[model samples]
Target: MTVLSQEKPLPKAKTGEFWDHVQFGGGFGISAGNDYTDITIAPSAIYNFDDNFALGLGLQYSHLKQRNFYNSNIVGGSVIGLFSPIEEIQFSLEVEEIHVNNTYSDLYNNIKKSFWNTGLYVGGGYRADNVTIGARFNVLFDKNKDIYGSAFMPFVRVFF
Candidate 1:
């Protein structure tokens, strides 16, 4: 009599393919000075289409107050595109549209204004397995709209 051998099945993948997963993270920043203070929080999601390209979207909120003078609130959304030809570096470009509300108070009068504005940012930076550190420039910067005081900005991100 001859015996037959049984075959074993391969393990199944739980999360599906590499492109099927999404990465998420958020960032925060705060600054204080003698006459001014600013705070910002941004949350984002990204989907990698492949080893070299990805796309993302983000939401932003910012608050600014100056000593007994004026205060502003901003809310916006952004879209981003990223490319990495090398393993440890990547390039990114982003565009954002925001709405700003400002209120000013003084001995004379108190006034308020609201408007919608847009900004463009382009930069490149070093990237590791789950973190990236980069500096970007605002290509479409307006002094009234860019509360950050400069066209150059630095950023850090983490993905899971």
Candidate 2:
């Protein structure tokens, strides 16, 4: 028997591209000056522009259940660039505008005496199958309060 082939191969993709993923996940972690437990609930979504870059949106509301901070409501998004300088490691750059609740302000207070606020958070992340972990540094863009005082959190995201 003899066979003939008449098929063309596909083109190659660029490196450090994350334009092939649509991600949705949730996270729970803690924060403080030390080993303190701060229960946080955050749901997030992302659209990859390449295999190495993505745009993300997240909505998070956290109560200082058993820690140092008070109740806060945050909604923000960021543009992330994925870089893999080594195997088994992924680094991401994030610039996000997070709106938080200022519990003590000069305006009318509702929603747990929380006032409106906005902040810019820069962070990095590492990805794994069915999980993602990262840390963030935030700068409040408001003149009311500075919550978190900048928090270092190790977060895990469960993909569904």
User: TM-score of every model?
Assistant: 0.80, 0.51
Off by over 4 Å in 1: 1-20, 30-37
- After superposition, the stretches of candidate 2 with alpha carbons farther than 4 Å from their true spots are 1-20, 28-40, 63-81, 102-116, 139-144, 158-160
* Candidate 2 lDDT, 1-160, residue by residue in tens: 9999887877667653554466777666667655334557677777755555555666666654323333445555444445544433556555554555534322454335444444455555576754567765555433346454444545454555
The worst-scoring run of ten residues by lDDT in candidate 2 lies at 102-111
The lDDT of each candidate is 0.88, 0.54
* lDDT of candidate 1 over 1-160, digit per residue (tens): 9999988988777766654667888778899999999999999988988889989999999999997899999999999988989879989999989899999989898899888888899988899997889989899988866655888989887878
Candidate 1 worst ten-residue window by lDDT: 12-21
**Cα distance off (Å), candidate 2, residue 55:** 2.5
Winning model by lDDT = 1
Candidate 1 lDDT at 72 equals: 96
